[model samples]
Each structure stands twice: as C-alpha cells, then as structure tokens.
Target: MKLFVNSLSFLLNVSVVALVVGGATGLAIIRDHQERLPSIEPLLDYRPSVRSLVEDSEGSPLLSLGKERRDLVSLDEIPEHLINAFIAAEDKNFWDHEGYDALAITRAAVRNFGAGGVKSGASTITQQLVKNVVLTTERSIERKIQEALLAFEIEKHLSKDEILERYLNEIYLGRGAYGVSRAAEIYFGKSLSDLTLSENAFLAGLPKAPTRYGLDIEQGKGRQSYVLSRMSLENMISEEEYAHALAAPLLISEGDNDTEQDQASHFVRSALTEVESIVEDAGDALAEGYVVRITQDSDLQGALEKSLREALIAYEYRQSAWKGPYKEDLPPVDSWTATPVLMDGDSYFVSINGEPLPLSKDSVKFANRGEFTLAPGMRVLVEKVGDKAKIRQVPDVQGAAVAMDPKTGRVLAMTGSFTQDGQFFNRAMDAHRQPGSLLKPFIYAQALEDGWSPTSPILDTGVAIQSNGQNEVWRPRDHNFSKSGFVTLRSGLEYSRNSVTLRLAEAIGEEKIGNLFEGMGIHKKAEPGLSIALGSQESTLLDLVSAYAALANDGVPKRPVMVESVSSKDGTVVYEPEDFIDEREPFFDEVTLAQIRSMMAGVTEYGTAWRAFEGAGYTVHGKTGTTNQARDTWFIGFTQNLVVGAFVGFDAPEPLGRGESGGSTAAPIVRAFFDQIDETYRISDYQLPDGAKIIEIDPDTGIPFDGGFKEIIRED
Candidate 1:
C-alpha cells in the first residue's frame, strides 16, 4: 500500500512538471510572434486622405473636395455614453482583453461553423483597429494570425483610449464620411457634441455595415434597437434611458453631400485650375489636405449675379414687343405646368412636359429683329406674378462681369455666366473675344506717351485702306456714318468715332500701338491692319480689366491674383502671391496715365455713357466698346478704389440689335452696379499725378488757350 501511494505521487508530480513546461513554451512562442509583428508607432501619427478645403478671403469655407470627408476628434471630446454605446455594440470586453476576446471568438467560431459561413466576427476594438490600419479583410488563418499579433503589439504601445480613438476615426461611415464627426454632419447635419442618445445609437450601429445601415432607416432601426438593448444589458445605459432612446424616432437631416459641389462652381473651377498650375501633383496635394484661399467676395458675387440677370432681362423686355403670354397660346389650366424654360425679364415661358409649344409672338418679340432662333427641345416656364402671365427662359442669355482691386489685382467678384447651372465655361478668364473699342484706351494711352494731349484733335473723315489680297476697300466710318470734321482725342474716344481712331493709328503706326497694347497686358499678338486701331484684338475680360487696372494704378500693371495663398494640412504655406506686380519698367508715363484717366472721365460725364450715369453722384473714368454689328458690347470703368468690367454678347457672335451699342447696352449695367455700392466706397475723383498740370486749353487744336476751359497736361 505504501509503495503504490509513492508511485501515484511521482506520476502526479511528473504530470505537473510536463504541464508547466508546455505552458511556458506556448507563452514564449506568442511572445516571439508578437516581437516579429510590425510596430504600430506609425499608426499613432496616421492621417487619412482628408478633403481639401477652399476658403474665401474672409476664411469662410466655399467648398471641400475629396472622396472621404473626415473631421478628427480627440477622445476627450467623445461623450462617455457615445463610447459606451460603441463598446456595447462592438466589444463588451474591450477594456478587459489585451487585443482580442477569446470567449466571443469561440462562440463566433461555433456559430460560423454551424452556418458554414462567417456569421459573426469576434474582433475586439483593438483587433479591428489593427485590421483597418495594417491588415486586409482576407479570412485566411495566416492573415488572422497576423492581425492578432499586430493587435497585441498595438495594445502594448497604445492605451485603451488611444485604440478607441484611432478605431473610431479609421472606420468608414457611408456617404463619403470616414469618421464620427463627419458621419455626424452627414447623417444629422450636426456636430458630434450635438448628437442625442438616439443619434448616438444609430451611429454606433453603423460599423457592422455602414452602407446597409446608413441608407435605410428601417434597417438602421433594427440595428439601433439591438445596440440600445446591448447597452442596457451591459449597464452602459439605464433602463429608462434605453427605453427613451428606443422610443425616439429616427430623424435624419438632409445631407449636404453636394452642397459644396456647385455653389460658386465657376469660381471654384477657376481656382482649382489655377491651383493645379502652381502645384504639380495637385491630386496628391489635395489628398494631403491642402487649403486654397481665393479672393472671392460672396456678397459682391451675389450682387454681380443679380445685376447681370436683371440687366439682361430688362434689355430683353425693352427690345421685345411681347408683353405677356397669350391666352390662346396658353395650355389647358391643369395641363400647363409652371415649368421654367428661360428667364426673359420678369416673366417665365411656360410649357407642359412632353408637349410641343411654339413661342408666341409675345415671346418672339424680344428676339433680335429676325435673329431669334429656337431649336427643338427648347424648354420654358410660365408663372403668374400678379395678374399677368410671366414667361422666362431656363438658361438665359449668358454674360460675364469682373470687379477687382486696382491696387492688389485681387478679383473681388467674378462670374462666368448669369447662371452657374447650364454652361460651365468661365467667361471671365477663358472667353477670348474681340475687345471692340476696349482696345482704344491703350492706343490713346500710346498717343499720350507720344506727346499728344487729351485735347489733340484728329480728323474724323472717311478713311479707306486697300485689302492686301482682295480688291475690296475697307472704309471706316463713325457709328452715325457721318464725319464730324475734327474732334479732340478725348471727344473721339468718348463718341467712339471709328474714323478718328483709324487716322490716329495711321499717324502713330499700328505696330507701335500693338507694342503698347502688349506692354499693358494684352497677351495675344496684335492684329496687323488699320482696323486694329478700332479695338479688334482678341483678349479675355480678365486681361482687359487688369490692363485697365494698370492705368488705374498709375501705369504699373498687377497680374490678376485669383488665389491669395495655399497651405497644407500642417499649416505650411505652399504657395503665396509673389512677384505679381509687373516690374518690367513702367509701360506708360505717370503723366500720360493721369491725362488718359481724365479724358476717360469725359466718357461718363458728357459722352455716350452720359445718360447711363447722369445723376450717379460720383465720377468714373471709363470706356465703352461696341463691336461691329454690336456683336460684343463692353464697359470697362473704374473709380479711385475699384475697377469693374462688364461684357454682353451671344456665345455665337451675332448682332445684339439695331441700337444695342456699348453705351446703351453694357454701360447701363455698369451704372446699375455702381448704384448699389455703399456711399463710403464712392470716390468723387482720381488724384492727378504730381507731374501733371491742369490748364485752360482750346478744344479745337489741343493747344493751350487763355479761355476758362480747362484740360490736364504734362509739365515737360
């Protein structure tokens, strides 16, 4: 009996020794595996490809562009209930476990085996974080081992809160939202701090399947109820709170997924193009979370848009005889849907869907004297404003306007078209059209440099130039087709006399004028012909405005600055406006600029643009441009503080109408814009340069006269 007892003790002792040895060997293997895993230190500094933001000069976000939208939040900012909700839904034993949950994994294994598929994943928050950060979704045992090993290593280096924070931010929530903060905005249109218990539960339920749960509220409700039940069962939430949350209705706010997309779209597009030109690999830069600051004034932009639309509508109404929609032309009361086709002045052209409706005589009346053509599939809308039916065009006639700061060359307001929807072309900088008489100012500036004062007289008689190859003779005549005998240069420009301008160009040499035009900022090579003097060179509104701004800045040209600066996510300025002031020697003498400016003032005071600003209460130096047949009309004007340019024309060049000259057409729009300016911005007159002296001069020969009449001349 004693020998058997001793043998049993020895066997038990041997069993204990073997168990200890095996357990130690297993622990060493795990430690070695953990050591072999990649370090999670890089994850501590991990940053996702956040959306790039475009801001206005005032620091208001104008737009954001990217595939993923994320706003990072610290763990402290996360509410305790929010964290508890996620813990209950994803991992109840998250704090207790190092990297994984053994019991949950065993239960999931059995369930998956029973179902012959992956019914559930028992990954802890840390394990999930490791998978998202470093591992793929592959279900192989090798991948699972790697994931487990990485999670253990991560837990050793990072705290529970750190793991939770990273996991919350790295997970994808639907609608291009990647983090809780962004998801909060996407789902509720509110910040994370503003989320209610029900909203919190809804978000907590999304990690399982964000798309399925995010899109359908019914599906989300089921998962949300499960999450709330789990929270209650885990004591994370009181039973009363759980009940209240479960009873709460799911109210989803409208997602602003595309809100930043189309607002100020034309300006945004232009800014993006400019940014791309400066930053090579702009896509990568955007992904790295760059911020672009542009010089767009939202208030001014809104006003500019409204003014352009109103001006076009008013012009169309004046030109057209159609008062309103005809009763006979109207569709049946119910069948006539108030579909908006095109905006004509105050009326909208109405039509029924899928119906063929001819434009009534009322609608065609605005059509430029037999120049209106309506294509098939044209749409219109009609609405009752008061007692009359008003018709409007869907995509109204297009136009562009640009306002800039002459000192800094900053574009304060710009629009590519009257409406941002239909056409995507940016007319402000991209549309290269004939400047018409807008080029005349540069020619006159050249004349000033050549010692010709504003009162220099030129013959306004018929001038003929033989075509180089054709037998046709080009005889330039005034708009009135009558000669004025002789007129001062200022008078010639104010009246836009074609004959006077052509003769002056002949005497000064067109090539010299062309060189001066290039020096002033007209980028295109000047057209070779006597007609070039009549403003026939192709230039963009931006270039033309900048050139005029040079004159406003006293002969120093400033490159138009659309983007003020660009910064990266780390707040490093990547690009800034530098060397934009053209220092290639002064193109025009200060006295010449001052003299021309004074002469341009005549255009607004007593010339073609007179009626437009008769009682405007302030003086503006400006020039009016009317192309041949009035295809393009322009008004480039400036005060001491601002420079604004407006253009009206058809996309396909055609005569606007019989009397739609720049003075009568585009000048009125400019006047309407200035009328809206606050009194503080209004400047009564430009400060004359020191070298210039005002003296009484004879209007006929531009020679000094002792009479009371006064003119500005350079003291050479």
Candidate 2:
C-alpha cells in the first residue's frame, strides 16, 4: 500500500512538470505569432498589376502591353457558376473554413508522408489569398504557419466576398494573364460573365497548374473533368448540368483572337514606342491603369491589312508559274500538313496527305493570300473555301502602308509590315528607302513655285551630264526608256517623265529643290545631283506621306500624329498631345499649290496610276514611283481629306522582277485599300481656291486654245 501511494505521488509530480513546460512553449509560440504577423490593410486593398490598354479614337480597345495582362472585375460581375467551380475545385469547404482546414491538413499530411515528399497542399481559399498577396510561396513549416496566421487576420478584417475577390484577381492564370477575368478573355476570348459552364470548369482547373493546362486544352480537359465531377458530388451543380459540362467539348478560342493578335497589332506596337517615351515608367504606367488614346480607325486598319494581303497575293499569283505539283509527303487531309504550290489560271494546287489537290476557283477566291503564298517550299494552311480548297501562304515578303487624315494629321491606318505577330520592326516609320518617282511631285511643286506654269513646255528628250564626282557621263531616261520631245510640264509630271523632271530640277537649281523637299517634311539630306529629282535621297514612308499631306492640305504642313492623348487610372489627364500650329507654315503660295494639285490630279486621270481608280468615281491626286532596276516601288497620293502611302520591295533591295513598276505593283495595293473605305470617308473632289482660273490649253504647246480641254490655273 505504501509503494502504490509513492508511485501515484511521482506520477503527479511528472504531470505537473509536463504542464509547466508545455505552457511555456505555447506562450513562446504566441509571442512569435504576435511579432511576425503583418498588417492586413495592404492585403485588403489589393492592387494587382495590369496592362495598359491602347484604344482607338472611337474608344475601342486596340491592344494591351505589359508583363501582367490582367482585367480587373468586381466580385459582383463574376458568374455564380464560375465562383462555384473554383470553390469545388480548390476548397469544397471554403465557406466553413476560418483559415486552414484541419481535416484537409491531416489528410494531406498523411498522403504526403506516404508519398515520401511534399505534394498535396492543405491551404484554404483564405490561406491562398494570404500566400498570393502577403506571403511567399516557399514551402516550409514556418511559411505555412505564417500564411495561416495572416489568413486568419485577413478573414477578420475583410468580408468573405472581398477575400474571394482579392484571391481571384491576384492569382496567376498563365499566358501572361493574371486573374480570372484575364484568363477568361485569354483562353476563351470571353468575359467571366460570358463563360459557359464547361469554360468555367476549365478555368477553375488552371490556378493549380496554369502553364501545363492553359496552353494545351487537351491536357486541361482531364482536370476540367475532375472539377466538374467534384461540383456534381458537392451538389453545387445538378447531375444533368454536370453531365452536360462533361460531354461539352472544350471550345478554346482561336490563338489570334486575343488583343495582341488583333487587326491593330502593328499600329499598337508602333504606338508603344511613343507610349514608353511619354510615360514615366511603361510597366508601372500600365499597372496603375493608364489608357493610351491613339489615332487609329479600327475598321480602316482592318481593311488596310486585308487589302495589303490580298494585293500581295495577287502579285505573287501573277509572278508564279505552275510547277507541276508540290510532290511532297504530307499529313492527313484535315491535319495541318498541307503545302501550297503555284496558282495556275483557275486552279490552286496544294499537297495534302501526300496527294496533290486542286482547289476550285471559289475556294481560292477569298483566301488570305498575304498570309499564304505560292513561294516554292512554303508551308501553308489549307482549308475549304466555299466549294473550293483554299491554300493560305505564310507571308514572307515585307510591305508597309500608312494612311493619314490630311486635315488633322491623324493616322487613320498604319501597318509596318505584312505580318506583326510579334515582330518589332516598324518599317513604315523607320525604314529608309528611295522614294523613286514619288519625289517628282515635290519637284513639280518647286517648279510651280518658280513662276513656271504647268502649261510651260519642257524637253522630255534624254540629256547626258557629268555628275559631280563620277567619271562616266550620267544620262537620265524615262521609265519606259522612250523619249517624248518637248512635252509641257503637265505632261512631264503626268507621264512621270524622268528626263523632263531632271531638266526642271536643273533649271530651278538642285539646292533650291533640296530646300523645297525639307520644307515639305523630308528631313533627309538631298544628294547634289539630278537623281534627287527622281528620289535618289532615302526617306521613310511616313515622311513622304506627310509631305503629300501638305499638298492635300492646300499649303500648310501638319505633323503626323499617332497617339492623341493619355490618361491616368483615376481619369486624370497625364499627357495630352496639343496641335501646335507654330510649326506649320505655308510652304507654297495658294495659287502655286492649286496648280500643283491640278497637275497631280491629271496623273490619276490619265497617267500611270490611271488603272488604280479607273472606274471608281472619286477623283484622287497621286504619283507612282519605281526605282532604278525596279528595286523599290511606291504610290503616295491624297484626296482633300486623306493621304495614303504604300511601298512594296524586298528588304535587301532586289529587283521585284521585270515589269513590276510602282504603277503595276504598289498602286494596286493603294487602290484595294481605298476601295474598302466607306463612302462617307471618301472625298469626292478637291475644292478649288477662289483666285484659280480655268483656261483651255493646247496639248502640243504651252498656248491656251479654245478647242482644248479646260485646265485650272491659279492666279494668286
């Protein structure tokens, strides 16, 4: 009896010691928690990084640029099914969990211990929000405890809806996108509210493994199926709804449907350079919700891209000769393993599954020829086009087009190259190439300023001269290498006569002509030779187009503008581009400018660009230019309201082949672009100034005649 009593006393003492030690340890943990816990204010007011969106003049989104591509939406805007899908996939007991789920933690610990490594996570939705916003993702006992403590603090401060909203918006959803809203737009090209049941399920499965599933919808399907099953098991969705979601195929949106691949991609990319220059920090500016308003017309931009592709394709078809067949091994018919061959008359040839198929006329009619070509060994996308097989060529040859509002110098449409899929080179603004005969209008403008009327006769006969630093005698020839002796200045410009322009430039003096070009916005230093009259000086398409805008604007030169304004997140104006008329000065007298415009009008009426707008009732004044050896081709023109410039040539400056002049190559592209414009946007005619007089001039001589056609003569 004494031994038993002693044993009980010792057990009591041991229990007392155990309690004291345990209490001390627990107190230490509480102290550490109190010291390490972070303030929940920042987490509650979460501000996610977002991209800066570029909008057109009409307020339509053109493109977005930044590291994080996110579109923030309120919790109220999120669909119920989408929210439930996430809850079912991530944490089924999200509503009941305070911070961490004890049951889930125990299960995860057991499963991880069995697997011999950390794999599964027991983090609740609150804990996930904590980890994403305030805590790091490092896997450790300390980090997990800190996350749990922070989550509990967050839950105490924010409501359930607020926590869910923060978590949804802060989570990364892959493809450079963050948050559910961006994920919905990126993966399905729809808003969170617009997402179907199956799409919501697909998006719910992304947070866990975004890259692995978001890029490959097929791989994501399995995870989506698992999520749908969980929703059904939890009774969040009906069995019929679950079954429908499971049976519904994942309809991923096209890759090019995103804002980055939109019609204004090139324009957006070009505008980004200017955006960065104006903003304090581009990434931060975008993250803080800045908006860039640019001078782009979405409809006109789309039309420009389409017309450029079609025109290039037609050019390729014209140049291509049928080479029997593709004759290469290809994949299955529906598979993306087809190769495009040349188009012969009515047939478009392509090899599919090692068999050559001839596309019917109807099928090839509407194909994106710019994207696909008949270039030898070029792989293309073959699809059915209205009862015919269409072969689309991946474009290789580069081209540029720029259209501007002459009245305001606003860029209506601008494409640097045929393809902008991630390419950064903006040829329209940066590429410097010979203007070819596009410079003749400036020479003619200078001639009209020198008191020489368009009716004055100039020798179109060939003339040889010794260039300043050259040993050989330089002889200038017309584009057709044929001489038309003693043609008037009107005929000289109308025919784009090289010899007559050189003579006119010589009579006016080369230095004066160079000064005239600089006044019209050509900043390049003109060479001291007659070739300057033929556009030997290298200039950008932007500058050349802007120069023509001066002619179209009656005499005042307006600077070309792309970005119109920029605003901060709170609707505060950060930067607004103001039109400074101080820089715009009259380069020519009103009468001289009128005469120049009239002479340019004669070009489209009967000159090389006649074929461009032959049947189109709208009258346009323009000039077509072809460099020596046909290396570069250009057609720049303007109506009273708009000025457009187009260029087509190899980057390395090689011949575009025989007979491919600016009139034949570049003019057609401009024609196609203008044809797509709405009638309201097209200018009918150039309004004549008050002091201009109409006089009938003889075609053979500079004298006025009663029998000849009447021409406008400016008398200011």
* Residues 195-237, model 2: lDDT tens digits: 9999999989877666446544666899999999999999989
lDDT of 1 at 20: 30
Candidate 1 regions off by >4 Å? 1-49, 67-259, 262-264, 320-391, 467-472, 481-484, 698-707
lDDT of 1 by residue, 653-704 (tens): 8888888878888888778887886654458566677888898877656677
Residue 199 of model 1: what lDDT? 92
Using all chains and alpha carbons, the TM-scores for the candidates as numbered come to 0.60, 0.62
RMSD for all candidates, in order, please: 19.5, 19.2
- Candidate 1 lands at a TM-score of 0.60
Using lDDT as the measure, the top candidate is: 2
- Each candidate's lDDT (Cα)? 0.71, 0.72
lDDT at position 45, candidate 1: 76
